[model samples]
Target: MTVNEPTNHQDLAEAPAATGEVADLLAMLAKQRHFLRFTTRDLTDEQAGLVPTASELCLGGLIKHVASVERGWAAFILEGPSSMPDFTKMTEADFARRADEFKMLPGETLAGVLAEYADVARRTDELVAKLPDLSVSHPLPKAPWFEAGAQWSARRVLMHIVAETAQHAGHADIIRESLDGAKSMG
Candidate 1:
């Protein structure tokens, strides 16, 4: 979609109706994705990788990170936490490799990242739509921030994904503005 395209809410109204909790979750996700898409629109690979802010976050990196996070969470919803990568035991080199997933590293392009983000979103929507129970719970992976024996419902997972995407979308907005004085939203 173009930067001047209608807002996500407006576009969603024209699409098929999404029912219940899935609808709500998808709406929020779509709004965040909208902003993320807007921020990256018309950007070159070089511009996407530019670190214009105090933070290490770049527009393209934010895109890639959000996509990867969403995909992982979706997998967790489908196949439990064991389906996720073990970040706790990652070596220094592993951490470095993971960090590259956020940056527009060699052979990475804005178009490629955006395409992957779209594919992940589509898969997530399909999974959520077909889920029989939003209340199905999965144990969270071992992490310093996670409480021991903690588990999250599928609904909760979807909410977390929405929150994560929205947070990064905001980061992308700031990075985009810093790069070229273009605002994702007023």
Candidate 2:
């Protein structure tokens, strides 16, 4: 049989709605990303950037943070722990730069941040699909939050991405509610 052709009738059958573990993960991540992005609908850059509640989170900033985090984790899956920084040696500037990821800076439009997030999401979805083995794993980098010497599989990383997106979507929902009584979930 040629490489492009399926060898069996089963392979020729129509695929299920989410045919595999990776597909399931991608589906979940997409739902969360949609919820997160929905919060910013009809918002101006000023509204997107406003810290409407007691906390420092803004709708645009939350989207930016989620996109940055997802991009980093997706890279970690392919490039291993080396794709991430050694949190132990993080400098003030590193922290500052991280903090900046949460703010819609001057001249920064909400549309721009959303576009970047969409791009990141697309890249991550492609990576998850193209990876050969979801079970492949790597040692986690030294970080205060991670257990020492711990390792995580590609599956785990994707799950973490889903969790992060969901958490931030909730945060965005709250921020949106505070800003204008809009509820993402009602």
Candidate 3:
């Protein structure tokens, strides 16, 4: 949901009220990252790789995917004029060939991806902290997920990242449990 700015100086002067909108979003993103970390802990390479179906989305792959998403969105938040990363640039064979995919690459391992996410989260947190005004607008990307002609604030984008990460965190938990008997995230 989009948060509207308060109209007057009196409303703007309220400290507690101003915090409620952005702080919740920041917290949510942190919580989701924590949960996702817990879910991915203590699994074998084979278990991480297993998909359980023909769906092409394994536990490890989800971690990779989310990290990429985080970076892409972070870039969007930082530089609104550029397009997000192109997944089509890398094929399945190419992904397999990446040194990182061999656990020697930057974003290959489950642990590595989580580590990268922590960095991304920190950067995103800094962005949220430095936002000049709650009403500052950024263009929301064209996607089936969000409504069209909708202008978003720094607060809204921060919350959207939190929501997106949280949703994927839940998925990661299930995928992790399915791979092994580890059931703590439930």
Point to the candidate with the largest TM-score: 1
Best by lDDT: 2
List candidate 1 stretches off by more than 4 Å: 1-3, 6-17
The C-alpha stretches of model 2 lying farther than 4 A from their native spots are: 1-18
Per-residue lDDT of candidate 2, residues 108-153 (tens digit): 8887888788778878887788788999999999999999999999
RMSD (Cα, Å) of candidate 3?
A: 10.6
- Roughly what TM-score does model 1 have, to 2 decimal places? 0.90
**Residue 158 in model 3: shift from native, Å?**
1.4
Query: Measured by TM-score, how close is model 2 to the native structure?
Result: 0.90
lDDT, candidate 1, at 143: 82
* TM-score, cand. 3: 0.68
How far out, in Å, is residue 134 in model 1?
0.6
Query: Looking at model 1, which ten-residue stretch has the lowest summed lDDT?
Result: 6-15
Instruction: Assess the local accuracy of residue 106 in candidate 2 as a C-alpha lDDT between 0 and 100.
Output: 93
Per-residue lDDT for 1-186 in model 1, tens only?
345742331222221356987788788888878877788767788998999988888888888999899999999998897898676897999889778877899888877887788788888888887888899999999888889899999999999998998888888888888888988767
Q: Write the residue-wise lDDT of candidate 3 on 39-105 in tens digits.
A: 6566655666666544455666665666666666666666762454334455677656542331323
C-alpha lDDT (0 to 100) for residue 117 of candidate 2: 84
Residue 111 error, candidate 2, Å: 0.5
